[model samples]
Target: MTRCDWAENANELMTRYHDYEWGVPTTDERETFELMTLEMMQAGLSWQTVLNKRANFKVAFADFDVTKVARFDDNDVVRLLNDAGIIRNRLKIKDTIHNARQLGKWHAAGKTMNAYLWAFVDGQPIVNRYLSMVEVPAQTPLSQQISKALKKAGFKFVGPTIVQSWLEALGILDDHLATCTVNHLSK
Candidate 1:
């Protein structure tokens, strides 16, 4: 029943995420966008805090549907700002809308969101063998490259650290500890 140590202290919300979602590879564009949005919202805050408010986020942001969110306007911004169920940070909330627009632009430009996201790692998930959370990195050079590229592509709120988490969330980077039963690359 062993898991990544971080998940040990995770509440039911996090435990479920770790067990079912974390580290699982995903290629769906909408799902990828959702993960990136959630990870972006997680910046400067805890995953649990975001997880606790995930439902609110989903509801507020059109269930993480990038297309619908991309259409959000000033009125949507005002509404989100006044909501207590989710983080009311104006910049982050506004950025979600901007990020969705960027996602649409990418799609319009013939870019496969999934392929573009996976290209950083050459269409493969990175398998790590950390023994503990301390050995895990907050960011890597590849993550930095991806962040820079994504920012260049017009995405907001995506820094190296945030991109790193996004990569993990997309399962493009498998950081599960060697001791974790869910470790995908354990020997």
Candidate 2:
């Protein structure tokens, strides 16, 4: 089973993530929010770092529960900052809280993060057939558009690059390499 080049040399966790989760479309609200929050935490950092700390993040951010995270206070912020297992960036932590609040508003309005995001692609994943990771772009016009929309909708720390990664992680944008086994699986 040939994996994507990036995953081939990855640690066990990343290898598992690539094989089972990456590029797999999901509509679960908690999972969607979790991936988005992880992407936000990944700004200026490698995906490996995020994956490495995912377990810690899940614990620190209340299992990525939208309502729970949205209710997080400054006390929670202080707690997260002192956690050595996860990234300790204060702005990212606060933005995750802010984004969770935005999701809370969406929930109150009878909307879902899944619906709002999948709507951008007309309810289908955008499949890309790149042969190598090098062909995968860091950001694209679609990401820029989504970033603008998310920001306008009250989400923070969601710039184009982060949005692009989030989209990929959510399987809204399938970027599996053509030669990778998961490429066929995602399709």
Measured by lDDT, the strongest candidate is 2
Give per-residue CA lDDT, model 1, range 1-187, as digits (tens).
8889989977899888887778888888888888888898888899999999989988888988877999999999999999999999999988989999988887888886799878777888888879989999999999999889888888889999998998888888888888888643321
Taking the tens digit of each residue's C-alpha lDDT, what string does model 2 give over 30-56?
Answer: 999999989888888888999999999
Per-prediction TM-score to the true structure, in the order listed: 0.94, 0.96
After superposition on all CA atoms, how large is the RMSD of candidate 1? 2.4
- lDDT for model 2 comes to 0.90
Clashing pairs in 2: none
Model 1: ten consecutive residues of lowest lDDT: 178-187
lDDT at position 80, candidate 1:
94
Give model 1's TM-score versus the native structure: 0.94
Residue 186 in candidate 1 has what lDDT? 20
